[model samples]
Target: MWANLALSPLHVAAGTSVGNGALLGLTRLVSLKLAELRITDGDCAGIAALTRLTELDLRNSRVGDAGVQGLSRLTSLQCLDLTWTQASSPPALSSLTKLNMDNCKVGGEVALRVLRSTRFPKLHAVHMSMVQVDETGRELLNAICSDSASTLDSFMLPSASISTVRFIGRAVALRSLDLTGVKITDSSWGTLAMLVSLQELELRGTNASNEVIKSLQDLVQLQRLSLRQTRINDGALPLLQSLQGGLTSLDLSDNDIQGEPALQQAWGNLQLLESLQLLKTKVTDAGAHSLKQLGASLRELHIGSTDLSNACFLRACEKLQILHLDGCRKLTAPVFQSGVRHLQELQALTVSDCPFISKAAVLEVQKDLPLRYMSCDDEVLFSAKKTEPIWKSGAALTDRLQELAPYDERCRYSTDELLSARYSEFVPQLESSGPLAAVLRELELVSTQ
Candidate 1:
């Protein structure tokens, strides 16, 4: 019987090869990911036998034309990534849906073969960047652009030209766009305004200006927006507010988002927001206070490198599960003691580069450790080291409880928290003893009832 298997996101070493005999039992593979490495011709020929392959990623590798040519027989292949490879000729694949050949040597001849609408009608997304194409290639590129604009729902190309954007700007069906890597200095930045159907947009580290920001206000369907490392300023508040009702997550990190007015102006109305990132901004105490309006809707916050005071945690909404306080110079241990206690839902916390917070200080504040993961004082920490050993076997835990002359309040509190969180509360199959274990059994029975 053939097993359902998929080996993915695999980084191969240089000169990685596998003979057909070596893969004796693996008559076929579900997927082969040989990205950023060199595979021999023998390996390429051997890989051609994998007719069952559905996904293949060959990004940034030394895969030659012969290696990619062998994949033509893989009729079931759905997604193919040939980014930054030397493969020039890609055979017409009938089942391929997505093709990423960014920074490849595909010229006019290859474009005519792959981009032609007559051959691979199933192709939906065509991602290409920095491809040197001849005059014939340019003509075929226009045809592909026209075809992709009318039918394709997703088109992503960081190296896409201005003309390509103009063509796809008419794509009313496009939903997800990752043009963050595109450096648009002209009206091309404004072209995104036409994509009203877009549900996700990432413009991180791009040259988009205030005018370009205004252009995106019409994208009401957007649920996720990333404007990190951009020239975001107070002028974009109205635009943000326009999308506030629909946005669930937004990243405004690494920008010149100074003062509280910028946040207060637009963020107070974003009650539906579940996650927000403002790392490396100059947000003040009042700016953070605006987040309190979100209440329980806010779940994750990244407020690193801000000038906020100790009250930052108190104002960051109490229901946060993930919090990052790295590079927070103004905050001290008292913030954790006072504000973090209210954050019972917090599972992950990072306080790296904090001048005052030490590992010892965090441990001293803890009675029953609740954090599943924590990073502080340049050391990585996990809750398993402190609590998981006890949870491994409930019988052993019952023995430890019996030895106790008096039950420590901390022990009781932490155990209750673990039970409530349901991460490590019981081992039902294993038998437990002792009076404490009996009490736990009764508690579990009652809780279940």
Candidate 2:
């Protein structure tokens, strides 16, 4: 039965008896992925016989304590993904090379014990999000990294309340590190700069300032760096410019970086830069032109929420592939006709919220370019055809009731009359405004309803 087993989603749900019948006829089963199944303690008996299984993914399944106990028998298992399951005491996963338990109920001593006890000789990547990994946990992880040598490469511990900075100097072999939503002091940044082998680093939602940017200059091997929602400003640009020769992708999105001088000084040296995102930044047409200077190697560019005209985007039309100009209400048709027509590789173009762009301009671009995807008014618009309906007929009545729920005191009419009203006080205003304006109108109407 084991030799004839064909792993599928249907086979796992039919019960372990059916799986055991299939496993009995199999000789070599390398991978077994039971993702999003309702497997219970009884199903563990079927997995115990899969000694030759190398990869196993039991993510989003009801694998309780008994199910984990059964997993201990499979000594040949290399990769295990038990993400989002309810198991406080995880079974010893010594043979696993990659383990993922992100957003699980496991916490405190039990979480640290799993990391401490698991003797994974080949373990490289570990994803343990929403776990309580404090100072002592960092110490244990440091020991693991020091012992693993070159094997440990990727570590994602986002939402793991890591207040102290203890494991920075120890994890030298780490290539990709995601420290999003972690609380780290200035000293932590200095310690992290010492890890010379780091390639990809994400400090999104962290309190890292411009001072830490100088320390990051030492990480010459870093290729992709995301500083979204950080306190970095113009002062940090020079330090980033130092890594121009090696760095390829840079994200400064959601930062309060004002003016064009910092961008010009930093990006001027980045001859190999391909992807750059300035989403929600205060960059204007001047800043957009400064970025266009790096057009030789630039492929993907996002300058969302800025007051940029289509002319600013036309500057780098040749190499641009994915361009997001969302929330740029000032963009006109002339910017597209003159510049965007040259971009042969342009696949995805977003022109959301720019009411100035006439329907004729959109049709012209669609006719001239090879754009596979385009979005306007949150609806797909391409090839001079509108495929889907934007709003349902009875949606207006339902929306009016929801809007009036918060401020029923202000309305003189009854709930039944408001629901049945052909022309409610909110309906006319919602129809006139755009999507974002409509949402704001509803909030205002609720207060007066």
Candidate 3:
């Protein structure tokens, strides 16, 4: 363990044998991630010794008030993530440059005061979801913004009753701001537009409308914008197009965007756009045809739950690499045979719940093309011949056996099938593992499978 201590972001979650105390001895560690270990006061003492740590993520841990007290000693820590930790803090994170205390129990005025008094000279990003910030707290934030020595880049203060827009306008260097579930009106959009350096803005679940869109037209460096569940509609399209060739990713999912003409007129103008997600929209093939105009630059496209057919997708397959047609029931076999064959660079394809796609077509495509990744529901069918099945039963298991069963009649298996019989399997051994463990396992399985 000491030999490999140079690896930053060392995650010792549920399954691994490494304890919290052993992890603490790696004083050279810059990033320590021990999430969902059911860590308590005793476990946090180990973390307190990691004085040189910059990023400490204890998310979903059972750490409580005692654990919070232990974290106060980590003065060198810059980024502290306590999301879903269920910890009632005495505000131990004063020197942190980035702090995420989302869904925690640090919402009172005392908590705010403790956070405000902290000497975060380089604090840049903060996430305080479900915290109760009143007028005074906003004024405190305003004071923090006025500090010329500090550089706050991103802030998420959902449920904070920040009424006035003037306070935020003062944050000249802010790049990303999320005020979801706040009472800020459309008029505040003008004030927020003054933030010249703002790049990614998320106003999801907000009351802001087309006015916000119009206000953001002047932000040239803006790359990613998410206005999910907002009142903004097709009227916002023109404002979005104003960004034109600059914006790379746009997510207007879960809105009332209807018909292809609106999307066509909107997206056809984003020439530099690479990723576009229009999930649960009223877009049809006509709208998809309009999207095809962007085929030259678009790399990742998601049209889930939309009224689209294979023909629409085929029209734009020339440059698509990551295609997600999940829940697009109308997709047919000819679509894969014709449309997918043209996508020479296609690396990952997902057609989950699309009853129209047959197993035979999937195998034929794997045999004919050089796809590196394919996922259908719980199973991930792949083309690698040396990999073994990751799971043997349940919906999580791939039906690859059934697909290969017919060819193998009493050792009559096809030579190619026999060579490719092994399927990579992923099964978690630890019950207390965090989401990251699952992700790592999946990634390892993907590389082998």
Query: For residues 1-449, could you state the per-residue lDDT of candidate 3 as single tens digits?
Result: 66347767676645554456576558788887765566666777777887888887776677776677677788888877777676644345556677776665554454465556664556687676665555555555665566522388987766545555566777778887777666674366688777788887767667778777877877877877777667877677767777633777777766777545455364545788787776666666665666766778888776655466745455565777766666667767777567777777776666666788876666566655556666565366663434643332221121122111221222223334433544321222111011222333443433332
lDDT of 2 by residue, 172-199 (tens): 7889887776778537677777678889
Leading candidate by TM-score: 2
Identify the runs in model 1 with alpha carbons over 4 angstroms from their true place: 1-61, 65-77, 88-90, 102-109, 112-120, 124-145, 149-154, 159-164, 262-269, 312-316, 385-449
TM-score of model number 1: 0.69
lDDT of 1 by residue, 7-49 (tens): 4423344367645564434545776666555654456666667
Candidate 2 deviant stretches above 4 angstroms: 1-28, 88-90, 106-118, 134-140, 263-268, 342-345, 383-449
Better of 2 and 3 by lDDT: 2
User: Rank order by lDDT, top first?
Assistant: 2, 3, 1
Q: Summing lDDT over every window of 10 consecutive residues in candidate 2, give the lowest-scoring window.
A: 425-434
RMSD values, in order shown: 13.2, 12.5, 10.3
Q: Specify the poorest-scoring 10-residue window by lDDT in model 1.
A: 426-435
How much lDDT does each candidate structure score?
0.61, 0.63, 0.62
